[model samples]
Target: MTLADILASLFPAGHAVRVTDGLVSGDGPLGASRLAVVGIADRTALGVDGACTLSRHVLDVVQSGDRTPILVVVDSDSQRMSRRDELLGLNEYLAHLAKTLLLADAAGHPTLGLIYGHSAAGAFIATALATRVLAGLPGADPSVMDLPSVARVTKLPLETLQAMARDTPVFAPGLDNMVAAGAVHAVLDPDSPLGPQVEALIGQMGADDIRDRLGLERGGRPVAHTIAARVAQDAGGG
Candidate 1:
């Protein structure tokens, strides 16, 4: 599904929206909150401008102190790579964006990210990963980096990396793989009515990162549970 489809699913008919430089800002479901949805459909990148825009909206929400829920709809395929972006300190901008989202969360605002398309690398971390809860549309692809990119960095043969991905979901780049590894909270079905599901989740919101536990329960990342338990036991002087 596209970002437009996701937006339509969340907002009612005739809901007013403001779109500027690829960032879409509007009132959320039933006028309960504000949403800043970021993405460029044809050209898949989140640049410094987009980052700043989202950061500003997040700061606005924090300042409002109404605990307005933040809805993130990410569809970027990559972070913008350019000499100008680097000269402008793109990393700092992304960090600012992340910090703003965290501040909103600290202010008691529930932040949720829905991946509607391809998301990877630094852009994914800056937007989707910053959320309190992250989910993906069934066809969404989420990754730290693509397998070919990883192979180039690690100096591994492409065939070997492809083989490894089949058995390991940790760094695999698909929604189902992320859900299995606890990277994505869930993969949403497009046919389902998203409004009621979102409202239900909003009602149950809490300040807990429970994906690791979920991974263990789903038999997808048992090592996370084991390591956490071991760390806790050692900390207790056991």
Candidate 2:
């Protein structure tokens, strides 16, 4: 499904949402408060400008001294690969965006990532990875790099990589694999109306992030929780 389709389904009939330059900001569900949604459409790459705009929105919510939930809509293939962006410290701008979201969360606002489509590389890091909870649509996939690109870089046969993906989700590129790896909290059903799910999640959001535990319980990820708990216990004993 397209980004517009998802938004329309989530915020239908006088939702008062606004989309400009591929950034969304306006009243959230039930007209409770302000929120932001950023997506990449028109094959647009999220560059420094988009990053700065999103960061500004988060800062605005923090300055208002109200808890505003920020929803990041992930649908981008990659960040804009431009020499100018790189020369002007694109990584730093991305870092600034991530830190701003963290500040917002600290200020009582919650950040959520809704993966509706292709999410990868630097774009995913700057947008979705910063959020507290990450939910994905059925077809959504978040990966460090697409398999074709990985194979090209590693000089491995494409068939070999594909076979490896079947055996190890670490090499896979799908929403289920992301859930298995503890990178995605859940894979939402595409057929169901998403509004209720989104609203319920927003109402139940808390500071405690449970993706690691969830992955272990669901048998998607095998050891992240174990290792993390062991480290936490060791640190506590020290």
lDDT by candidate, in order shown: 0.76, 0.76
TM-score to true structure, per model: 0.89, 0.88
Scored by TM-score, the top model is: 1
List candidate 1 segments past 4 Å from native.
Answer: 31-43, 229-238
Clashing pairs in 1: none
Residue-level lDDT of model 2, residues 84-187, one tens digit each, is: 88888888998998898788777777787888878788888887878888888877767878889889999999899998888776568788887777778766
lDDT of 1 by residue, 129-151 (tens): 88888877877778889999999
Candidate 2, residue 30: lDDT = 43
Estimate candidate 2's RMSD in Å: 2.2
Where in model 2 is the C-alpha error above 4 Å?
A: 31-34
